[model samples]
Target chain A: MDQERIQDNIDRYLSGEMNPDERREFELEVSQTPEIQRLLDFNRKLYKEIEVWGKQKLRKRLDDYYSAYLEESDLDHDQAAQTHIADPIPAVLNKTPRILGARWWRMGIAAGITGLLVISMIFFIRQQPKVELTEETPAETPVDSLEEIAPPDSLQGRSKSKPGKEGEQPKPQQSVPGASKEKMLKSQPAYALSNIKRLPKSFVRAADYPQQLQYTFKNGMLTLYGDPLIPPLRLKLFRQKGRLLLQFADDFFFIDPTETARPLIQIGPLSVSDPQPLDESIRIRLANLQESKFTQSDLEVWTGTSPQQIYSFEEKNGKRALILGGLPEGENPLVYVVNGQTCFLVLGSSVFELDNAVNQPVVLRRINGASSANARLFEGSKEFERKVYKIQ
Target chain B: MDDNHLIEELRNGNEDVIKYLYEHLPMVESWIQANNGSRQDALDLFQEAIIVFYRKVREGDYSHDSRISTYLMAICRFQWYTILKKKTKQQESFAQINLFSGQDTGNSSGEPKISQEELSLPSRESYLKNAIEELGEKCKAILEAAIFLNLKMEVIAQRFNFANAQSARQQKLQCLKRLRNKVSYEYVMSLD
Candidate 1:
């Protein structure tokens, strides 16, 4: 039999497309021929591998669902804690005031008798004469007087009540200077500072006076103004979550990369120049920013780096992720920004987006093509060698 | 979901079943930890148990005589015991023996008793896995679509933009040939 015929028979046999007669004939052929049997064995093994692949695909989906479940559970717990523990004073204060209905007449009689007794006692005390102050006398404060006047049973009840236990007295709100401001600062999401280093003096002069700088890219070249001491610094543009972020030195600015008239962004003291035309590379890269579907395995293969650890952390989307290691790193770690399902790859200053790159190595293979294009543009410049930041 | 519904979902390979399966992890974890296993060990053992359970369900070997939690716990206990027995070869501690004595361990059904060999992937399968990955994206997709997903050749051709079912079949065969060569090369290198 021809190899094609044998392959067809094997495919049909494995797919269960054969009848009993065809299956029996195929088994006889397999029993007589060693080569055909080996081929069948290889196809069977391949079939198993495909099954494994399917399982892995299923596992990936399960992992995603599990991550979302954990995130949701965590959020629910946090919200419950906030409602019950973080701020409870409002809950206590919102209770309806008790109405003293039937006991009002009896309470009026008791109050009239107490008022006559207090009037007689005050008259008696005035008649006794004033006491003299001495050096050793400790002044009786209002708090001390109130404590002395409090009923013994109420004092006992106060002593018995534990702090933070049910029915305990609400804590008095203490005023701490700048505490709210500090909390606000703490609550804000902090920029990742591990990969950012202090800008070298060569990049920007410390004495430059401008508070805001505007820069533009025209024909693949960056133009800056105001600071003659400043050399051409490498800039990285990437998308975090859904916003475009530009990073240079230790500072990053959120910008709308699509806007034709770039907004004046404030960076410390360096002023940047505006070019007559936008760079074609930046325009192309901005247009390419989109959602991608690269799997954990594809990331491992392309970057040639495995995660040092697998753990969960809350992402900006308010979902917890079991992220694999820090980020993509290597000579040319294609995708620099991976936020949820979106991925962006950096080639020099331009950022290109990759979509559904998993099981699609061709998208990643384009990195070589993009890199060569960058190589031709920047040739021998230090900008070509700058490490791409792996911003999570 | 009830056991019947869960079993039906698992048979359909619905990934939502994973969330349901995870509900059983804590039980399995506690059992493994009780048997001198660490949390990580419990996690690894439980994951293997889940895979075994999933495979059994897909293969229609799972018997509904026991609850899903009970079945999963049995698999975890059996796997952990096998691991401990291997680790401490000579000393069969009394606790380990007592742990399984009264337990069902899914032996009643005689279908879900997973051995260590069944839990772990064979070395050849690992080699085949690497070879499949090395087969580039398109070839990998074609093979998986045709064989694993049981997708029709016509559907595979349409999805992959092939000219026809015949072309898709040819492409799959070509990919299989490359994979065979790669696996053989890897086997030869391993021998050396």
Candidate 2:
């Protein structure tokens, strides 16, 4: 290819328009011809320089525009107006489809101005869904009470099945089969079971429950359903204090204390309080089941030839407590712990456990065997050894 | 939004799309400035182009035969060229080179010795920096659609409603030529 022709193809190539044959030919000439190569390099640099200059200039102009806009609208001075100016355009753009139709653009400056005005509030309000309070009323009383008042749709949507628009006849209540009305009424000791009909199937508790009884995971909540005579109760478990504070009605019923409690469970960094603590209520439940949980003060890190780092410990109370982190590097690693009287061994992401000493001691071995099991960290150990760790 | 989805929206004259375009005006401006054009030039070009695109799509003039980026790039390139010629009377050498390259046969002695790197300009970071700095929202959009998005001329033209693919192609050629003209060849060559 001649220098001029080769140079023309170079632009096409940069713009990614060159056909495969032309591209191949262009590449061939570029290697053989130094002048062409120099020319290509110059073109490339020129394109890049212009691109960078354009972006920088654009950014400066945008900043200036935004500042001027804010100033013109008096948003900079007005605290309330500042909210709109500070609202991110990306966020508005992202939500354009879900909340506003594409016609949002046609509304022009009016919509833009209005949207800007409400931008900060939109973000703040969107993050919080209206929390509906489920009024806990006694189910034993058949007569309609103020507590039985249907929550407004503004707060919580009520079923259309309710008879009468506002001051309607009370609808027939139906309790799920097997869970009798008496049993459902006595489920929660802290609050009166208001509308048993509204209770979800999973929320339905066994009619008869033991008063001073051991609780196990049923469905997904630690429910205490008993006789209606049982007064309302309040139970708050604090991890730091390691105590279970239970109050019935106005009186403090019991204070079952322990030593291993953690902060409340949080979904994200800043999110609503996760009250559904059946599986998540491990730390609090441990207080009721186990007399005391024993946790090792120091955390030991297990490192080997592999990059995997494992930390294990034990809290042997009533329930086996194993704290484990960092395991085998593949998918679906299992965790288990064997309990003993004196020592608590914890296995984490790694599916293995072992008993160790300065010399040779029995080690807990993982049950699952693999092709490369021997090559992994823990290959051999006794299965029955007491390896205790805190369970999640 | 997906390009096709956006095209549909634009065809429907969705207000949100228009608003979004207005909001991202700075991006188009940046693209223009990056390609050796000015913010004001980019604004006029982009505004006109988008409206034209909307009208075309509304009028069923555009067929979904090509990627949206390609068509819009074509229009933006053309708009840019018109602006460039008006700004600078100098005959754009890059455009001439582009026209010449199309007719000129590639290297006859086909060999594997040639490296694609030899034909490449500097990394996008260097020369385009100043232009990008001068860019507004519309310019940035046009540049990114053409350069970063690597869209075809026809698609961009259709998206932005340029007259036609050929005009779009010519326009892109001219814009690039303008940028080439502004570039300091001596400084760029010294980097080697």
Candidate 3:
């Protein structure tokens, strides 16, 4: 048979549309022809995969619809519980196959970044002491409840931010079977950051305190430069695994003794409330720079190592960088940025190796050409592991 | 409910059944964690496992010898293991160390190396999906109606204003053939 005929037969057989005689002949021919058999097998697998693809898309659409419905339901319930028992009614009603949005690729990227952020969150849990709501601060804000917050449609999400009973960890959501899609919509797991305070503490803008703070992470201690009038508040925090996290509040920048953008390089807008976070990276010191992720980005930088390759960040001119462990010793691998805004390399790690190589930035060969991949750091993607460092 | 009933609910696409599956995510969560898989890995894998499980049950003669939760966990374990196996070059040694160290001690290191052909399955599947998306809005509507909604030819023909079920069957056949061609082209390009 011709290639076209064979292809059609394969399709017919896989689709379960073949007539009895046609099916018998095709099966016999398939057994005899190795290539034809492989084709049949692959087409069959592809057929099943297409079904799965459709199902996956359906699930995503359902998830979006259910989540939006749940967000509406949770408006009145301020004392946020960890798991919302799904209302069975909503899920059934909302199964009318609707594509949530055309930007699934973006969601996939955002999901990956969210995974990284979750890892950062796990790391955050280890370093920061549990958040204690000040007695005057209205109510205690626990991270558990904060994670469950649905984004406010019209500031309704804030009501849920109010701290739960003193120290009770919101119990892990238990599945209540027989719940309607309506219930599931209300009880969807906390997938996205629903509000502003839900942002991690580490990622707020560092430029908030221009003169009042000078944070330099070097030699295992965070060097802070604070205002002379106030007692210098220095935390003995150091960079971990070549990453340094600095936490700053919006109110901190409010008191600008000397109003100038001279020393305080603005990485992003320092604010408690904004649907979109800032998108900026500042090279505070050549060796160390802070990349504040307040918003989403289309292109993301990724570094992959061979399975056996062991590398460490080495301090080249006070900036610790991911240098191959066995490479012949050299200067800091420089990633050049012409415009202060659109940069080639932002020090993903907060902890910088403080050095005297201030104005002179080392430029390196882009041997491993910077490749772009889709990874959106979702809304409120910045800030994890809230640690305040005084710039000494 | 009995195990059989649980499987039935899954097959029926019960929202409660799906939600129950998700609630049991923490069970596989630990296994993924210890094996260097992230929470996101656990999330994606669990969902896929549930869908696969549902389809398997939807097929005839699926026995309910064990608890649904146990069965779900087993499916998740296999899915994750296959994913990891296809991933790492040193997966030969890695699979030996199972997600958790205790079970399946015998025939551990004797795992076979995944073939290039099998390795290409996922990318091919992804390519096939993209190809389907490019099948145009009309094709999407017709094909989705037939395959996803499981509509009969007569109903689909009337819905799309076809003259008769015969014409609709012919159109559906053509669509299937086109999809096969698109998927095959994608597979070949993926190999390249």
Give the per-residue lDDT of model 3 (tens digit) for A141-165. 2222222322212211222222441
Indicate which candidate wins on TM-score: 1
Off by over 4 Å in 3: A1-8, A16-24, A30-52, A55-392, B1-17, B31-38, B57-65, B81-130, B136-138, B141-169, B177-192
lDDT of 2 by residue, A25-97 (tens): 8768776777777677666655544433433343334444444543554333364235435543554564434
Consecutive 10-residue window with the lowest summed lDDT within model 3 chain A: A369-378
Clashes of each: 1, 100, 34
Worst 10 residues of 2 chain A by lDDT: A201-210
Reference A-B contact fraction recovered by candidate 2: 0.14
TM-score for predicted model 2 compared with the true structure = 0.27
Provide DockQ values for all models, in the order shown: 0.10, 0.06, 0.05
Ranking by DockQ: 1, 2, 3
TM-score of each: 0.33, 0.27, 0.32
- lDDT of each residue in B17-86, candidate 2, tens digit only: 4433334445556667786764544544554445435434543445533234434433454445333432
Clashes (candidate 3): 34
Off by over 4 Å in 2: A1-8, A17-25, A68-274, A280-392, B1-145, B148-151, B159-167, B182-184
TM-score of 1: 0.33
